[model samples]
Every structure is written in structure tokens, then in C-alpha cells.
Target: MIRLDTIKDIIVFLLAYIPPLLVFAKFWREKHKNIIVLIIITLIYLGGSIFTQNLLPFILIIFDIKFIKSAGTSYLDNKIDNTYNKTKFGRDINSVLKFDYNRFKFNGRNFSIFSALKLSAISYTVSLLISIVETILLSRLNVKLEGQEVVSWMSSMQLWRFIIIIPVMIIFAPVVEEFVFRWLFFEKIFKNRMGIYLSALISSLIFGFAHFNLRSFPILVWIGIFNCYLIDKKGYWYSVFNHFTFNFITTMALLIDKI
Candidate 1:
């Protein structure tokens, strides 16, 4: 029998995402409109969320597969065939967003400690700036919410939770999250102004909701939107950097207080 923890997320992921992903992939190959596909994916995510299961991860895997296929196609067409690459949505984001396999190859940029630090710095700075701006805006709206408390408390450097947390924040979180939210979803979904706004909005909302912190949901939402903008404005690198840095710094801050 599967462990409760293992089976829970695994089953949820498969049931919530596999059908829609297959449908979307087949539809994409046919060069059809992806509205229905997106809708199906969205419902799967919503269902997964409501059920509090691992469905999101499963859906993400499907999306990841699609992204990999697109990337391979893009690389081959650009390098070998000279045909313009197409996104899963049948739109080309490559004219502006270039993915250098040499630079961003799996064993290349991302695996390097230097690159990770650089990414952490950029992502943290951007996230901090966006958080500041958002704080100001929400203040003007006369709404207040909880600040980082338990995280701060548990993060005390005296406790050593931070030492463990920092690496998790930096290395573990960035790779998967960036690949899914920024690289895969943003690359596939956001094509134009409307799509851009929607992508940021939807993706951000999902990002926040995923946290499961009801009190901080709004803030997370705003952060998600800002992160999406950063991804569009700068590149996936910026988002990856900001995300790692933000998490690392916050965890450190908490750790320091504990110390």
C-alpha cells in the first residue's frame, strides 16, 4: 500500500491533470484553438485545489512535458531546419524570448552556484521592490494583513532551521517553481496584452492560493502578479532570481531573529 502522504498527492495529480493534458497536447499538434484546452486545464487545477491534493503537481508535470517538447522543437527548428518555433498555444514567443540551450542547458547555467547566487540576488531585489510597491498600494486602499510571523519565529538562526531552510529556499524551490510558473505557463499562455494580463493575474492568484495561508493570500497574489511582470520584462532568470532571493532572505531574517 502507498503511504498516505505519497498516495494522496500522487492520485490527485494523475486524476486532476492527465486527461486534460493529453487532450491539450493532441489539440496542440493539430494546431487548434487552445481556449478549450486551457479551460480544461484550469478546471483541473481548481478541482485539485479544492480537493487539497497533489493534482497541481501532476498537472504541472503534464505542462512540463509539453514545454520540453516545445523547447526541443524550437531548438531543432531554429538550429537545424530554420523554421520558426511554435508554442503549445501555437504562438511564437521565441522572437523575443530566446532560450539558449548552451547557456540555460540543464547541466549549464542553473546548476552553477555562481548562476544560482546571481539569480537569487536579482529575484530577491525584484521581489522586494514589488512587495514594497504593493504594500504602498494596499495601504492606500486601507487594507491590512498579517506580516511574516511564524516563519520569522521558526527561522531563528539559533535554531538551525534556517541553515536547512536556506538551501531549500534557494535550490529546491526555484528550479521547479520557475520552470512551471514562469517558463512553462507564461511561455505557453501569455501571447498578447490581454493574455499577458490574464496570465499574470491567473498565475499570480494560483501562486498565492497555493501557499494555503489564508491571511497572506492577497499579498501572495500581488507578489505573484509582480513576479509575472518581472518574468515578462526581464526574463525567466529574473523571476527565478527574485523567487529564490525572496524566500532565502525571509527565511534568513527569521533565522537571525531566533539567533
Candidate 2:
């Protein structure tokens, strides 16, 4: 069993969950541009996922730009400073995070790049191992006297399981999340070395919180940060494949759990 005491577990939960939730709630009510929203979401996410929280992870999981009703005015102060400036480029550049597909360049020369594959495999493997450790640790925690109801709620989702969610997780989530979090969010805010680390940390936290399960938050953050690194280093497709691999592995684990 995971030998953590009740107090220690609570401390971990609070550290990981509070910051991101504060950030998310801070900006959720405001009106901002897509770029701004993207930046704040990433920041808030980082804050929230630092500590594992039971209810907060679910909120983090489904929280994407599309699901957000509209952009609020809670503009990212730094991102806006960099993006909207008086230059020859009179209008904002939408091409940076091109939503349309034709703009996606599939350079034939880089078709069999080993670095990309290696990065994806290594990161995915690391996340899988981390998640396994977290699950085992969580299973050992003395079930919180007050958390049984919450666990029951989560258990209900197990009925449908991986078979129903793998496609959505691997394909749809990677496309949408990478576009919003990395292409849009990281591009604007993460300009310098400090910004890069901050962006990766925040993006990972948000990714972790989105999962809503305390036991899984650590793994999600690990995966999220790794994906952030891939995106920062190799661009969009790298992050996508890394994300797909992590989810695929998780889906397999979930399936195995059924047996």
C-alpha cells in the first residue's frame, strides 16, 4: 500500500488542486480573445494540477476552448503585449494556429524522422510508468471518510470504460487540445526561457486537473509537461503523437483492469 498518512495525502491534494482552480475561476467569467483565453487557461491549469483534488480533476478534463461558451475579457496581459502591436502587420495573424487543414504542411522529406518517434515513445512510456505508480499509491491511501461518495460517482463512469472513450481521447482530444493549448496558448505567452517553463508547467497542471481524479493527476501532469516539451521542441505533430501514445496506453490499461 501507499504508506502516506491522511495528512500527507491531504497536503498533496491541496498543493496540486488549488492554484489551477483559482486561475480557472478567475478568468472564466471575463471576456477575452481566443489567444488570451488560451493563455489564461494554461496558466490556471498549471495552478490547479500541482496538487491532486477529487472533484477538480474532472473540471480540468473537459475544459477546452470550444467548450467554453465564449471568450471573456480576461486577456493575458503578456500575451496581448506581444501579439497586438503596431507593425506592418496591421491585423492579427490567424495563420499561426491555422484551424483549417490545407495549411498543415506534410513535408515529405521528414517522413521517417526518428527523433519524433523516439520522443513520443520515451515520453509515453515514462507517463505510463508514473501513472501505474500513482494508482498503486492512491489505492493504498486510507479511503477518506468523506470521499466515498465522490469515489462512487467516479465509479459510475467505469461502466462505459475505454472502449467508448479511446477514440475520442486519442484523436479528437489531441487535435483540439494541441491547437488550443500549444499552438495558440504556448505561442503567445511562452516567448522566453522563463515563459517556456511556465507555459509547460501550467499546461501540464491544467491537463492534470482536467482528469478530476486525485489518483491520476500526477500522471496527467507528467504527460502534460512532456507533451508541452515535445510541442516546444518539435512543433504540433510531435505533441499530438506523444499525447496519442499516452492515451492509447491508458486505454489499454483500462481495458486490462476489466479483466
Candidate 3:
């Protein structure tokens, strides 16, 4: 007989796929366009995974206009920027690259790198707290923490493999994920506050689900919320830094555990 906890796990697992399914359903009328986009993203991701062991960095470079015109500026950047400008949440994409924290002020003071780093630290701490809470909840529910395939794979990799992969995890992953999930998917697409919140929920849910770690889903979603807040307030790079710092710390922890 299936235990009650197993049934709960199954329900959660099925619910995790709901966002992507909704996305497909909403775009069913534009199925051809959606399919083409998905195919291109998948190919780029796979190529990076096969060759470099990192997908997001390659995707970011390929999508950057400075690197390649057709694949970068014409196809991805233009579409994302155009949509961004038309939305209420829109800001100049160029500003994101400029690192001008002065554009954002808090408590009558201009935002600085120090404050940004502080925010990143706070976000990381909050994510950890959320993870602890999630773990406790799962314990109470008698659900075994499942879905650690990525961690298992990482543990089995050689030193050289880690050296090659670490930079991608710290740098490329943050940049690419922020660009795709927060900038393009959330800010560029959503307009109102309600839309933004809904976008955050759905996008974060999808982000968590992508990791294939059901036990870490809530923690990932919390991180997603923190990232979305950064992008909405400051710009994409703020969230990128937050993401980078989080990944860097997590990667180090995993490395230490391996040792």
C-alpha cells in the first residue's frame, strides 16, 4: 500500500509541473513559434552541456549581440528588450550592464556596492532559513527528502571536472538564469503588481521544478522571490550578483562535503 506521505509526494510532484503546462496551454495558438523557440533554447543548452559542462554562460554569450549577431542581438536581445520597453516594469537593458547603483536609493541614500552585497547576504540567509523550515515541514509530514541526482553526479565528478564547472556555476548560471527567468519571463512580460506577483509565483515554480529536486522546491522558490525583488527594484545584475553569491557559497559547501 502507498503510504500517506507517498501520496503527498506524488501530489506535490504533479503540482510542480503545472506552471510549464499552463505556459504551453496559454501559447497553444502560437504553438509553432513556441516550438521553434523551445528547440533553439534546447539546442543551445545541450551544446553547452555537451562541450563545456555549463549551459547558461554559453546561452548568455550566444544571446549577447557583441558575440554573435544573428543568434544574439537579432533573435534574443531584440525580442526581450522590445517586450521590456513596452511593459510597465520596463527599464533600459543597457542600464543593467552599467552597474550604476546610484540609480537606486534607499533611506535617502544612493545604493552602493556595499549595500548590494549586504542585500545578497541577507537573501542568502533568508533562503537558508526557508530551507530549514521546509525540511522541518517535510519531516513532520514523514516525506523522505528525494531528488538529489544533480548533487550525486557532482559528488562523483573528478577535480578537473569541478575546476571546469565551478566558474560556470558561479558566473554563467546566475547571469543566464536571471536573464531568462526574471528579466525576460517576469519583468518583460508582466505589467501590473498582480501580474508581477503571479509571474514570480509561476516563474519561480518553474525554476524550482527545473532543478528536479522536490525537497528543495520551497527553498528554490524563496530564492526566486528574492531574485525577482532585486530585478524589480534595482536591475538584472543585482539579482545576478545575488544569484552568483548564492551559487558560489553552495558550490563551496558541496566541494567541502566531497572532501
Point to the candidate with the largest lDDT. 3
The candidate scoring highest on TM-score is: 3
Each prediction's whole-model lDDT (CA): 0.55, 0.52, 0.61
Over 4 Å off, model 2:
1-91, 94-114, 132-165, 192-194, 255-259
Task: Order the candidates by lDDT, highest first.
Answer: 3, 1, 2
Question: What stretches of model 1 exceed 4 Å from their correct place?
Answer: 1-158, 190-194
**Weakest 10 consecutive residues of candidate 3 by summed lDDT:** 99-108
Evaluate model 3: give its lDDT: 0.61
Q: Write the per-residue lDDT of candidate 3 for residues 146-239, one digit (tens) a residue.
A: 6566666777889778767787779877766775677556765552545878888877876776676777788788888888888788766688
Against the true structure, what is each candidate's TM-score? 0.50, 0.50, 0.63
How much is the lDDT of residue 62 in candidate 3? 33
lDDT of 1 at 132: 80
* lDDT (tens digit, per residue) of candidate 2 on 102-214: 22221222334577678877886786688677667666884422322233443345647535555665665565556545644555445354577887788667656544566
lDDT score for residue 170 of model 3: 91
